[model samples]
Target chain A: MHGYTANKDDILKRLRRIEGQVRGLQRLVDEDTYCIDVLTQVSATTKALQSFGLTMLEDHLYSCVADAIAEGGDGARDKVQEASQAIARMVRT
Target chain B: MHGYTANKDDILKRLRRIEGQVRGLQRLVDEDTYCIDVLTQVSATTKALQSFGLTMLEDHLYSCVADAIAEGGDGARDKVQEASQAIARMVRT
Candidate 1:
């Protein structure tokens, strides 16, 4: 099981909603919606995607990262480093 | 015609690609992919959405906003303020 295994359905639901948001964006463009309106929708979609990422990060930290650290080994250090890099990518994006 | 009218096709294409990215994320989660790997994909998808928003904002500034400012009246001020608010929403998200 992965770090998010316990809440797999919830995660999938969030992703599905985000997928719908992307589809909505296409529909807006298809209808020649105003630029500012379309941009506003885009911002909303981006925020949803970012929120999903944050939830996943939190789950990972609470489960896999915590487990590794509790065991006290090189794996724990590596996991923390890897997680930090992932956070950096999210922030930069 | 809106600011993005000239490149409507391109915008739609980008949104389609982003939709695919979101679907891929679902597949990864379905397969119980590692948390870090999933988070990385999430970041990539978020960046793509943000980039799409920026492109729309640029087009708006070039066309609609520019036209208002050239007219030089209350409309110009209103357009600038509206655009500024849109930018704030994007950044805050």
Candidate 2:
């Protein structure tokens, strides 16, 4: 199983809260809120997603990647590669 | 500036490493690595992205969201909504 299984509930809860926040944003846009105000909200949302992604990465490194490294051989290499790709994508965003 | 600006360089550096990892994955696939092995790499990549997202979220909450809330009124509400949407999108992924 994936390492995230350990904290899946907590993660999901956080996601749900974030979903609500998005809905609120839509409302603000609908109401014709100020441009800077909307942009600020957008900035907040982007940060939140990035933060969530980082937390997950830490868990993966500590749990999944660590396990792979302990196992050694191709497993270790693959895990490292996987992690690197994940990081690259995050940065691009 | 976004809260992540402080750590943008670090984040980008990490991302560059991840990008290399992804390239490795493509190579693995090209070499016909085992199916389970590839799957494992995929899983790792996903987790890493999620983790990255979470990190950004934390920064947003601490900096941008906090600032908006401190300012009060519509700003606070808008920030909250934006955060919620970001979380929701992350979870959906």
Output the number of the DockQ-best candidate. Answer: 1
Query: What's the lDDT for residue B92 in model 2?
Result: 55
- Runs in model 1 deviating more than 4 A are none
Clash count for candidate 2 is: 34
Q: What C-alpha lDDT does candidate 1 achieve relative to the native structure?
A: 0.93
Q: What is the lDDT of residue B44 in candidate 2?
A: 55
Off by over 4 Å in 2: B1-93
lDDT of 2 by residue, A11-89 (tens): 5565455445555545554554543454455455555556666776777788889999998999999988888877776
Model 2 chain B is weakest, by summed lDDT over 10 consecutive residues, at: B34-43
Best by TM-score: 1
lDDT of 1 by residue, B8-86 (tens): 8998999999999999999999999999999999988988998899989999999999999999989999999999999
Provide DockQ values for all models, in the order shown: 0.89, 0.04
